[model samples]
Target chain A: MREVEPKLLKPLVAGFQLEKTLTKYIVSQHNFLYCQKAADLDASVGKTTFTLLRQINELQKILNQKIMLYRDRFSEADVYAVYCEHPDYEGLNDGTFVDRIEDMCELSTKCAIKEWNKSQIRNEAKQACFLFRERRKWLEIYKTIHNETKTVWLAQRHH
Target chain B: MSMPTIPPEPHRPNRKEVIIDLLESIALEEIALSHILNAESEKIQAFVGECLNFPTKPSSKEIIKFNKGVTQLLESVVMKEWILLRKLENVLDFEDDCEPHHKKCESRCHCSPCHSCHFPVCKCRCSHKKHKDHDCYPGK
Candidate 1:
């Protein structure tokens, strides 16, 4: 019975660790993308805008993957246990899962604005792209912190 | 210099009036953009209120779907206007140099009453004088 218990726990522990690693990676990548976008906005036209947007999309895909994995490995009951154990767990899970989602939404908004600015520039119209770029930066930070917080919440479930 | 010909009527459109009218038109576009954004924001606030009152369990799927729609709408209108405003600013930079011909008649004419018109109606020589006292121009 003792041997069986250890074996049973192995996969669960491994899965939990994998989730933590993935969450960290996603958060880091999100931050990197944001910084890149800001640098691009500061630079000359055409080069920075599209590149930054592509990076954002890539980071978003990675985040989605991690989120899916987290969902797949753990049942709602497991998540609820973590929520019950952690003091701030409810804060992390409630209202769209982290304040970061709101930040990302804001970033997505800025991306739309940036895209519009690009079109206007193509038409030879004068326009500022700074506002959108600024919002994107905030978004990147928000996503990173959000992922980290979720990962911590999950890790607490086991200990 | 040959005497300037006087119009039989008290209303005639002048070059200065036209420039002022153009400026007004441009200004109106900016105002329109702001109004549109304001209205959309109000709608979003109302939607949020409704969502808060909903008795059903909040589904992540539903929240995500609604969020996406709102993001798209903001992008389409508010973002587009921001870009347009930038382009308009550039146009203004160049047009500022030329002296307006209608500076003197701006008060008397209704053509450039606001920033929406680039051609001020000639109250001194134009034919549309007896129109109802509209916001700017009355008859024509």
Candidate 2:
């Protein structure tokens, strides 16, 4: 099922080329009703979906490359002008992006640290900020806990 | 009368060294984290895309199978993310958690390219280190 590529199904149905996996998957669609030509493919729902996915992926890749080229032709000022034009981008604050996270420190400590450990190369500045922020948060919380408990604990020990 | 002498203390780094060590550790941790997040995101995205494919109008049974695949992937992904979060928490030790906070200007730091802690020139021992005075070569 995972191996099925709808693009290859066209050739298989046309009797042009017979790949075993494509034939098996396509035939499984509807009792192996053979496609007369590429035009006949529309009637088969399964085959059409796979073909469209492949087509869309190719188009997206090409479009992305062209976009990069387009940006390359423009100056930084031109790019900034386009960036500022968007209504949603009020300014480049943290609010400019969504903050789905609750605790930045917790996210940094657990998931980020594990990922960082596994990574072969690193971006030091980014890492430094992450680490510093996590520590800052910890210190903030630790102070709060320390102040609340210090008097009670000291009294109990004296008694 | 001569006062009793106390033995000289062993070499110990100051607050500035402590800050540098922590910063370096943290930066390294973040780099590792970014990599994992990227890898997991890619994996989950691919799974969702696969689920979006429905060849011909799917029969009830086929729909069920498709939904099952998606549900399984989501469940696993959720667990993975949760596990990663927990791992991050553990990595940041709460033990001996306190450090003496020194108010220093972090402004000049983002100013320099060589990234050799351009925070204010302190009276710390690190000032004596040769690299501090010289122009640092960029790469290792």
Model 1: runs farther than 4 Å from truth? A1-159, B1-13, B50-60, B99-140
- Number of colliding residue pairs in each model: 26, 16
Residue B37 local lDDT, model 2: 38
Instruction: Please give, for residues A1-159, the per-residue lDDT of candidate 2 as tens digits.
Output: 112222212211211111111112222221211111112322232322223223222322322332233234333333233222332222212321112111222222323234543231123223423433442343243334322442335324433
Q: Of the candidates shown, which would achieve the greatest TM-score relative to the real structure?
A: 1
lDDT of 1 by residue, B1-140 (tens): 99999769788666445444544554455445445545544544444443333234335455345445544543454344445334444433434422242464646553442222323443323444342244445343
RMSD of each: 26.2, 26.3
Worst 10 residues of 1 chain A by lDDT: A1-10
TM-score per candidate, in order? 0.28, 0.21
Clashes of 1: 26
For A36-117, candidate 1 gives per-residue lDDT tens digits of 3343322222333333333333333333333333334444344333333433422322322123223333443445345665
Give me the displacement of residue A61 in model 1, in angstroms: 27
lDDT of each: 0.37, 0.31
